[model samples]
Target: MENKNKYIILTTMLIQSTLLIVINCTIIDTSTLEALKSSMPIFNIMILITTVLMLLSLKKANSFIKKETELELVKSNMKNTEDLLNLLRTQRHDYLSHIQAIESLIILKEQEELEEYIKGISKEYRITNEMIRLGNSVLTAIINTKKEIAEKKGIVFHVRCKNKVSLHGINSWELSSIISNLIENAIEEASSIENEKWIKITISYVYNNFVFEIENTRKINNEIGDNIFKPGVSSKNAAGRGYGLFIVKNVVEKYNGSIEFKTTEKNSIIFKVILPSEDGAYGEKAI
Candidate 1:
């Protein structure tokens, strides 16, 4: 659409300039010098008006593009929040079932099974608590949602976070895009395989930087070589399949962050993103 608009503008200018040149040449030959001079101001005014209108159009185009980008970010944040709320509701139902089961076990006087059941519940709650303690609702929601998706697809998803990691300078929307895109890609790749399907994600704070590392079982697709982060490049042959990593790379670089991926000898791929905890020298400090 943008290129089409540019071509239309160029063609319109070409036709206008040609007509103006033809009109001036005819006036120069058939009219008095004073008459031609009087017509020049009219031509000048026409050019001025066209230039001003074109400038205004260009300004509006830029503003529209900016708003479109902001709208996408807002939509992403809202989806993440909705997923988090849904997961919370599911957990609430699960807690009720757990309580009922425990009461039943107690009534049945199954001491050994009750002990084992309580232990299992404790371990599960610990993992959930750790994820909640990450202190960023966006991150927690995206990871949890992706994990659920991976599990439903028969892909094991594991997340490890030992500390309270925080993203001080990054907004929820940007953070959501980065983490969600990477993990979603991992899940998709892992799910494609028939065997040994699994995804592992590790979040940590190291050396004043927040680190996100996702690894998944994937066969090497040589088509993606070094240009995996480039736009319109994808292992999948579907339309609109490759822009996720490209956007992720752009957001990471916008914050002076770095992203790298490597394939393991075990037929697994890992993507690692490192972003500064504080704002980078050239990064936006809003969030």
Candidate 2:
């Protein structure tokens, strides 16, 4: 569409220029015609230069758009793969526990104990099934997977999510990326503390925005400064690292949303995100 508009505008301009040139040529004297003919080469050169520049600009713009689209698709696929891997890991870990329980029960050679072990497994399955009744499968899967990891690390993970959320405006891949990275970072930082570590996440729908807040226990040093979101600015000492916050900022800003960070002297950090409702237009109120 943009290319077509540009072409139409250029064609219109060329036709108007030709007509004006003809009209002026017919009304002008022979001296003027000679001068116009002599200046024809310059005019042609200018037109050629303009056309080249326009085409070059269009090509560059098109390339950039294509590259951006490709990057987005790759990011989406990566998120899907990550989610699948997390699920698989959880299942594998659970399977190990089941194997251990079965091995112990078989060695006891007691029929009653064997039946009880099977019942225990059934009860565990029922509990998992009940917990996943939250309606949003993605959210349930992610929360359950993370919960397991946090428990394994002896960190307290708390969640306060509303019944259902409008996922319309946001791409699932980008949303998952943002949430996963933030939670993972919180967990990692919290685990390093000597005292009890905790991460709290709250997701709620307010007026015309979907608000997400994550708080974690971590000491923020002066090294973070104002460049915490800058790519490759991580305190983790490895070169070519620190792109998590950069990714989060890019995804949030794409939807005209806002994110902020607050840190207390006591080493508690809170990250808040306010995104426009998917069904609402920019600067418009939600119904």
Candidate 3:
């Protein structure tokens, strides 16, 4: 669009310049024609060259926009597939655990213990269901799904949300992308620590702000490079693995929200996000 506008401006300027030159040639005496002749062809040639340049620029701009949009769609699909795979993996692991528990109970002949074990699992699932049952269905699904993954990884995950969050302008998929990337990074970083690794996530409305925080354990002296969030800046040596935090930053900034990271020498790393709570603003709604 910008390139097209520039082309239009250049075309107008060319017309105006040509008209001015013609008027001067007609109004002035014959002597001025020789003076104008030297510069007029050069000016016309420049106008033609600029027109061609504008066309090329517009074509390149259009191609770039199309490619970017396609890449975004691909990323969105990949995130969905990853989320589904995580869910499936959690269920598979749980099924194996259930079978093992039943087998152990059968060998020990502990009917009461087996029943109690099943009941305990059921209760925990119920609690998980309730924590993410927000007013918005999409957020509810995202939180609950991520909660299951966190539990499967033995990562202590916590949530505190209210029903007043407005999700008007934010797309469900983008929100999923943002939260999923944040939580996944937290889990991965926490898992690297030797201590009791945990991730605490809180979403709440305070005054006019909607606040979200995810904190997890990490090594004290781990120096995250200044360019850690840049695209392609990955701890992984392999390709295509380092874009998570870069996308997270982009999504957060898209909604006029801000995210900060803090680390203590011997403590934990915390990521805090604060966004406006106005209608149509991006935030997680309480179930």
Candidate 4:
């Protein structure tokens, strides 16, 4: 919408300026008006070229604004993540004590209680260490933070990346925005349903493109299915619930990437983004 508004304003100003120029020309003395006629074609051509260049400049400005906004968001997320980790570390200071207690319980022949306690700790560890060591720190940070958000909302978040998935030429922040937005939307949609809610993310390399598949157990309304990526389209029935996918679509397209999804009436939605791995494969190298 920000870019759209700029385009509209630029276009309006262009039309107004063109009209004013023509009016000024009409009011000139007849001899001068006649002299200007021969140059009218050239003047109009120049105006057209200027208009095109101005629009291009505006579009480039919009892209830079978006990049800066996403960068700030990433920095904010990283800071909050640092705070969250510190808090977790503080809480986990008792981790060793908890293990000692379990050992003491075992020494006291309390098999049943020790078993339950160990199982609980194991589950917690699973949630905290959900993703494999995929050698991509940016993606790891995104999944960790998003997983915490999902768990707090009673949503099950799972990641499957057994093999290495490197974003060959994409900026870490760019990939971070893409992954964060997709999973964030999935969490929102899946949490709305009354039935079982879960989100699964799988990352793999299909040769030239790195693919991200986020599957969730929520049925999207057909009304929204057609325009899901269009800005302001949301099934959540609330304002500010629709920008994630729109941003995802824009970034994916900027890289000459493709974003596709499959939704079913059976309460399942899968979004797949395939981005080229080679630098300059699709877009002007992101600044």
Candidate 5:
């Protein structure tokens, strides 16, 4: 919208200037301009050339803006890819220890302990498997990565999916920015307290809309609530602390989607995002 308004203002100014120049020429003394007829035509040609150049510049500016957006997506995808690789590497490294532990358990003939250890190990991968089942690599990477971060901070991160979701009009990077930012904020807020900390993420496709509901245990105060969506307004007092929701709000609006949240009776915050989907077969349900 800002860009559209800028183009409108620039075009209007160009048209106004051209009209004023033409009006001045029309009201000029005809005899006085007789000797400068050739120069007058050249001047008009210059104005036409200038107008064309201005329009072409505007077109280039628009093209540049588009390229910039694409570049940002590419950068985001690269970062997500890097994170996924790091996660894989960490898992691989842990597998060695897991194998060693299993071997030791087997050597000691501790069948019951071995079974429990294996169950616990398998439980750790359950969320990762579910994330992969989401059918979107970007979503899986962001969620799995953030889940690890949350768990490290002693936050119980849980995720639920009603079914496989289809992100019809949105790309991977856009999904990353939206989901990652929300989850990151949740992790930040949930990890701040000394009590029971938890984050719950729910995803579903309902009535042609892909829905994401992220609930985190936190009490929103008046100061944060008033300007939560504004840039630079963060609950944290650190430098460069805010702007997550601002970006999420912009990306959600870009795809004609809506994002909103409500505080639960238990003082938990649940952020819900609904984006239009290509397949419209699902029924509506509560998050």
Candidate 6:
């Protein structure tokens, strides 16, 4: 449809310009004919350039609109899905078991054991709440699940957000996708190391953008760090695998967002994404 419109506009311009020149030569006068003969080519050239630019602009607009539509559909599907609910249900069931164990510890009068259990549970609860602290329930579930996976694999996970973020007008699925893939990548990279493995996640709304950042403890090579967002590039040596950052970049661009890569002071790499929030930033809405 876009191409057809461009073609029609271009063709109409060419035909109209041609007939104008013909009309000038046949009916206007000799002076007008001479003027048309010299200026005609420039006119056509200008018209062609204008048409081409218009077509390019229209193409870009179409792509952006399509991406927005896809983002909306993804958000809708995500809202209707049961995966997050099921995940939380499982976590809740596990928490019940923890509660039972704590009760038994209390009844048995294991003072030292109960104290240690209380401390451990407090730390775990803090980490879990940090995941959803941003008030975006969808993003929270994703971060929570990933944190759980990281802990299960002996990877330390950290979330540095205290206030709930208002991630208004962002697609939940793509947002979840971005958060999940980055955290998973961080976990995978940190898991490859032997000691001091940790992944730190930060969510903030600053400078008119909702920021999502992931910094891990694994060292990154300059080569991988430089071309990290490119498709088919991965530090993990496996064929047909490196689409994580590629998809991440795709989603960020769809939302008119920006992503930055930096090598942290600890020689590890960090990915910082700044996405536009339609309602801008908000205050104190805990999830």
Clashing pairs in 2: none
* Per-residue C-alpha lDDT of model 6 across residues 1-287, encoded as one tens digit per residue: 35454565566667667756665565556456676577667666866776675676677668777777667647744743455567656668779889999999989999999999989878866654554545777776677767777888898888887457777677677777777778878989888899888889887777767788899887787778778889999987899888888988998998899888887777577889988878765677455
Better of 3 and 5 by lDDT: 5
lDDT of 5 by residue, 1-287 (tens): 35554565467568658766865776574555565574567667767866776777677678878768768876876687788778777777888899999999999999999999999998976655555446667787787788878988999988887866667568788888899889989998899878979999999876778899999998877678868888998888889877889989999998999999889988799999988886664443322
**Candidate 3 versus the native: TM-score?**
0.61
lDDT of 5 at 143: 78
Sort every candidate by TM-score, greatest first. 5, 1, 4, 2, 6, 3
Judging by lDDT, tell me the better candidate of 4 and 5: 5
lDDT of each: 0.79, 0.71, 0.69, 0.76, 0.80, 0.75
lDDT of residue 230 for candidate 3: 82
- For all candidates, the clash counts are 0, 0, 3, 0, 0, 1
lDDT for model 4, please.
0.76
State the displacement of the C-alpha of residue 93, model 6, in Å, after optimal TM-score superposition: 4.2
State candidate 5's TM-score. Answer: 0.75
Query: Could you give candidate 2's per-residue lDDT for residues 1-287 as a string of tens digits?
Result: 35454564566567557756764665574466686677677666766766765676567668768668657845754665476466666766897888887888789777798888888877765434434323345555566566657767988887787645565777766777677777878888888898969988887777778788989898666678578899998867888878888888888998898888889776789889888886643342221
Candidate 1, 222: how far from true, in Å?
A: 1.9
Error of 2 at 124 (Å): 6.3
- List model 3 lDDT by residue over 115-164, tens digit each: 99988877855643355555655556566666767767877777777644
Rank ordering of all candidates by lDDT, starting from the highest: 5, 1, 4, 6, 2, 3
Q: Assess every candidate by TM-score.
A: 0.73, 0.63, 0.61, 0.68, 0.75, 0.63
On lDDT, who's better, 3 or 4? 4
Writing each residue's lDDT as its tens digit, candidate 1 over 24-68 gives 686868657777777777777777766765675676668778767
TM-score, structure 1 vs. true: 0.73
Weakest lDDT window of 10 consecutive positions for candidate 5: 278-287
**lDDT, model 6:** 0.75
**Pairs of residues clashing in candidate 6:** 134-165
Top model number, lDDT: 5
